[model samples]
Target: MSLSVWVPIVGLLTLGALFALFSVGIAPIVGPKRFNRAKLEAYECGIEPSPQPVGGGRFPIKFYLTAMLFIIFDIEIIFLFPWAVHFDALGLFGFVEMVLFIGMVSIAYAYEWRRGGLDWD
Candidate 1:
């Protein structure tokens, strides 16, 4: 491989780095400095902040369960994209393996559904 081929890639990387640095460096000076009680407080998806327990209270298990479900499905998609793109090359073996993988994922989905893990209320 010739070092000349890497010139554009290195140039693009340096340009990206400079752009990110410039945006962050200029933000404080350009952005509003106004701070109020509401602005300073931690915000949650437009819901009013609840009072904290005198001692830090335990978080609801549902919150963790929902987060876990998101991660599980998100990882499933990551695997699926590569398999789909290579479908022609992988042929029958890949098809069977993906079917089995999807079957397992479906079982987990069904189990969560039965357990009310998907419910918001």
Candidate 2:
């Protein structure tokens, strides 16, 4: 395109890069330097950490199942946003496509539910 079109694009990219560099570069110098047993220890994945395996050496399958569910729903919601925003313009074709997409996802969800993939111990 023309210089006018490219100028803003280049400026925006440069600004984003500068902001990321500044934030990451300043954090080490300005943030806390203290380190002790707790700080050095592996995080407990949200629960109270101990000097042992985070989940008592046996990881919970529920956590992974929940994470996968979150990702699946998250992606579905992301797709819905664009379709929603352009619903009127997309008309019947878009509606049918979205219905098919939802149907496929629903089938997968039903399969998972039937297979106990959504269940927790």
Candidate 3:
């Protein structure tokens, strides 16, 4: 609403936009343009690239499952951090809620463990 409040927000946003534009614009000139078989190949963690079908080949279902589990746990940790910071304000009700939340997470974890979600082999 006010100049003092709006100016800083707009200024920061403009700065961010300028930085992004500069990086994307200058990168082609400053960065390498060399393209060979190795450079064109998709990165596969430090492993040698293997020849595959036209569309980069099929991904294993296990990779999807593992990624979903990682995202779930990552979100769970995010909630925990905010709850911990406001622990005092939440008091007994928050404590009970957190316990229930933790219980649900534990159940899901146990189910995954029982179903071999944690197994690599």
All candidates' TM-scores? 0.79, 0.62, 0.73
For model 2, the stretches where C-alpha displacement exceeds 4 angstroms are 44-59, 89-100, 103-121
For each candidate in the order shown, give its overall lDDT on alpha carbons.
Answer: 0.84, 0.82, 0.81
- Compare candidates 1 and 3 on lDDT and give the better one: 1
lDDT of model 3 at position 53: 47
- What candidate 1 gets wrong by more than 4 Å, as runs, is 43-56
lDDT of 2 by residue, 5-110 (tens): 8988899999999999999999999999988987887675666666677556876666666676777798899999999999999999999999999998898678
User: For this target, which candidate reaches the highest lDDT against the unseen true structure?
Assistant: 1
Deviation (Å) of 29 in candidate 2: 2.0
lDDT of candidate 1 at residue 89, scale 0 to 100: 100
Clashing pairs in 1: none
lDDT of 2 at 117: 73
lDDT of 1 by residue, 24-99 (tens): 9999999999999988898754345778742366566676677778876997899899999999999999999999
lDDT of 3 by residue, 1-121 (tens): 5689888889999999999999999999999888898777888644466676434676655666677678769878988999999999999999999999889888877876776678886
Candidate 2: Cα lDDT at 51: 67
The lDDT ranking, best first, is: 1, 2, 3
Kindly report which residue stretches of model 3 are placed more than 4 angstroms away from their true locations once superposed: 42-59, 119-121
